[model samples]
Target: MPGHAGERLILTGPLRLVPGTTEQILSRLADLGRTVSTEDGVTDGLSVLALSVDDVVLCLPTVIMDGRPRRWPSATVDRRIDLTSYAFAEPDLISAYAPELIEHLNVGHADQMRQLARHARPAETEGDIAGVQVSGLDRYGLDLWRVDSAGAEQVRVAFRQPLVEPRSLGRELRRLLDQSANTSE
Candidate 1:
């Protein structure tokens, strides 16, 4: 709080952790008579920032709207957020190497992306399928970028269950791909 003026501060993380956390921070800010602005939305393609405070690891997404960098809305993230004082320090394996994973998926697996895109929504996948790419990956799911003659759209494809470790990412993704392929046949 040293460099922060408490002006228009935006706190974002997993939705479960943010609201309660914001309440606590707001309480402190109220003591100083400061004001803040907060917004919420559902998105999975935002950039992530990992924060390690004490023993807790928080992976927060950052969004850029209207060509300006902005903090992601508080409602974007996987479930299960702790509210107590430094409850768990468990590592977020997915977030740790998301950039590399996303890059690999996008560059190496275009056909699979198209297959996975089949599960997005009938409307979303109805256009003249131009291209598909994996834009974001989290423990809960994958956010796909689908471009068609009409335009570009974002699609969310969730895992069967929340992934607990990095080793399962490939398995979950494979399961999704296989399921999608089978559905199309």
Candidate 2:
């Protein structure tokens, strides 16, 4: 927290769709005692709000307003919130606080990702017969490794619907296993 009051903090993560106009966003910031100013032109292909608190500045990315649902097109944002991803208009401020800020964000993001993966059930058995191990996961689905008498084979299991969270992936895997069992019978 100790840095140039002019140092900027940018939120580079996906924002939840808030149903409101741009003025509403400014008003909300005002309610939080942050006096933010908006720049309409291109900054990383998105309009952003600039805020200065003490010596540090904060930039927030705004959603593209296209008269559609405010939600992001993807079910989940794969990228982590990284402070280094932000560009500092002031070059002098970059060497001062960017490293510390990026390290903090990286630590937090790693912990959160580890927790999500921990909740993931990597291996599952189907009625004491077929067994599968989840090798990886993505927004689309699971990377499964099936083990059988023939041998172990890698399989990609895509979800019919985009998965928003690891828990949903678990449920989808169960559903797929059930469907597979029913078919085999």
Candidate 3:
């Protein structure tokens, strides 16, 4: 979700490797409009470096593999993703209301959460499941956190189409729930 810092793609890593003062680096990066692209490769990966807005060096090393995801010596891979172009995302009503919406869905619509999760990952719904909650959301989808006997995982349930109007959120959500129920039946 977009915050006050701006639209940032959060990459999981230790802050130590983020060069310069973390706050300064992030602020500078936000000011300069840029996007990062990665290629699928093995141990012999390419490191993409670019000059920051403040003239600092930004080293972005990417490692994406093909086929079944396996534990790499230096990195962890849970799944494979396609190389697609990302459109510029501006902060919208969805981002602004995510916290309240997430809380509402989790507290008042737990059953719907289960329905959406089950529709998204039916195999994972079987047996003694512990809980399901809406962890996040955007115009396109809801991010669900599911916990069961196996463990916990986040699943993204995308809407049939991208939401264009903030006022249509309720209608879109109802459509998703209805679709899920129909699919199960």
Candidate 4:
């Protein structure tokens, strides 16, 4: 069950307004290699920044908290994705990017309502606001979420679940790289 777990972690929490907290987070994220290629660039939180941040290129878990869950934790909002997801992706960026799996949930489906809260894939978000389609290779693209600032906050982080396992992707990538190198020589 461990290997088959849906996703691994849900890294979403409000940035407590403390001294230097923002700079610390931004500085650390900045060190994570931002620019990967001419076509791919990563950034801190906006699309027009010029510099880009590369997706961690990690295989992990994803957590999704539906805004319209049959029950409300405190407020009454329907057809909306709650704090964690938005707080994770917006103020971020808006563009078409190739998505990578960052956070994941141990499982994705459930049998009961309460079980859903316990079971389901955890969605981890960071860096930017984007969308991810769980299955399919070359699966489409990353769509940036539009945040209009309504006294609240929002974020968009896209985590795509690859059709193949991470191990297999490694092998295939290695094979391709090797082939390319051989041809170059």
Per-model TM-score versus the true fold: 0.55, 0.30, 0.51, 0.17
Clashes of 3: 0
TM-score: the better of candidates 2 and 4:
2
Model 1, C-alpha of 156: deviation from truth (Å)? 0.5
Top candidate when judged by lDDT against the true structure:
1
Model 2 misplacement above 4 A: 1-131
Global local distance difference test of model 4: 0.30
Q: Write the per-residue lDDT of candidate 1 for residues 67-147, one digit (tens) a residue.
A: 975454676432333545344457678877788888988889888887777667655665667888887888999999888
Model 3 stretches with alpha carbons more than 4 Å out: 1-91
For model 4, residues 1-185, the per-residue Cα lDDT tens digits are 11132422223333333234444645555688543233355433332222122221222333346753233234332233344554475321111121233211112211221122111222321222222222212322212222222221222222333323444433443443454456445
Clashes by residue pair, model 2:
5-55, 5-56, 6-55, 7-57
How close to the true structure is residue 88 of candidate 1, measured as C-alpha lDDT? Answer: 45
- Taken over the whole model, the C-alpha lDDT of each candidate is 0.67, 0.45, 0.64, 0.30
On the 0 to 100 scale, the lDDT of residue 135 in model 2 is: 51
* lDDT at position 108, candidate 3: 93
In candidate 1, stretches whose alpha carbon ends up further than 4 angstroms from where it belongs are 1-67, 70-87, 123-126
What TM-score does candidate 2 get on C-alpha atoms? 0.30
Best by TM-score: 1
Order of models, best TM-score first: 1, 3, 2, 4
